[model samples]
Target: MKIRRANKEDVTAIVEMLANDALGEQREDYKLPLPDSYYRAFHKIDSDPNQELMVAENKEGIVIGTLQLSLIPYLTYSGGLRAQIEAVRIHENYRGKGLGKKLFLWAIERAKEKNAHVVQLTTDKKRPKALRFYESLGFKGTHEGMKLHI
Candidate 1:
């Protein structure tokens, strides 16, 4: 498996992976409505300087997994940076093969390269397995992430 930066051409596979429940777990409130234009918008935003969107591809050039890393610069910590990991997904058939780990580690390295002070992510409470996985990767549940439906 090859991990690399995602390009606009990979949007279709990325959307499919994002829509899979096993990967994204997006609830009805946060569900991603798939449309051709959605991919275009995502590509545009992901290419901006503050964001890094990546994809994991197999030898066949199929995008099997993906994640996004966003860098938020801060003034409070003396110009420190925070890297937020989101939109992690792997194709159902490719799960349990350590692809997630590789992609996550790649994101961490990318964050370090950008001089980020911390890396953060959030997962639903129902996903105990995913929570454990994140723990094993040195991430801790530090706070409650509350959302309000608009």
Candidate 2:
């Protein structure tokens, strides 16, 4: 498997992966005639210098995994820069094969290369397995996070 920056053509596959799970069924739109909002968001992310949308592909070049990394410059923590990992997903056929670990480690290493002071991500509390996987990767659930949908 090879990990690389995602191109516009990879959006459809990524969206399918995003909608492959239980939680994704409610939040993601991977149906026929997908919404324009998806492409709009992709364009914004793709054009942003501080954002990276990545994909993992197999020997046949099919996208089987995806994640987004956003580098944020903050005034806090001695003017530190942080890299946030979000929207991580692996194709159902590719799960439980240690590919997720490789994808995550690749993101972390990319963050380090960018001189980020920290790497952070948040998982829905509903996913116990994901929480365990993250903790095993050395992430600490030290802070409480709250969000209000617009």
TM-scores, all models, native as reference: 0.87, 0.97
Q: Candidate 1 on 6-122: residue-level lDDT in tens?
A: 887877777777766843445412333556575766767676899878899899988999998999999968999999999889898999999999989999999999999999998
What's the lDDT for residue 50 in model 2? 98
Candidate 2's residue-wise lDDT over 25-112, tens digit each?
A: 9999787677888889999999999999999999999999999999999999999999999999999998999999999999999999
Q: Which of the numbered candidates is closest to the native, going by highest TM-score?
A: 2
Tell me the spans in candidate 1 whose CA falls farther than 4 Å from its real position: 22-34
Instruction: Evaluate residue 96 in candidate 1 and report its C-alpha lDDT on the 0 to 100 scale.
Output: 96
What lDDT is obtained when candidate 1 is compared to the true structure? 0.84
Which residue pairs in candidate 2 have backbone atoms (N, alpha carbon, C) closer than 3 angstroms, thus clashing? none
Report lDDT (CA) for all predictions.
Answer: 0.84, 0.94
Q: What C-alpha lDDT, on a 0 to 100 scale, does residue 56 get in candidate 2?
A: 99
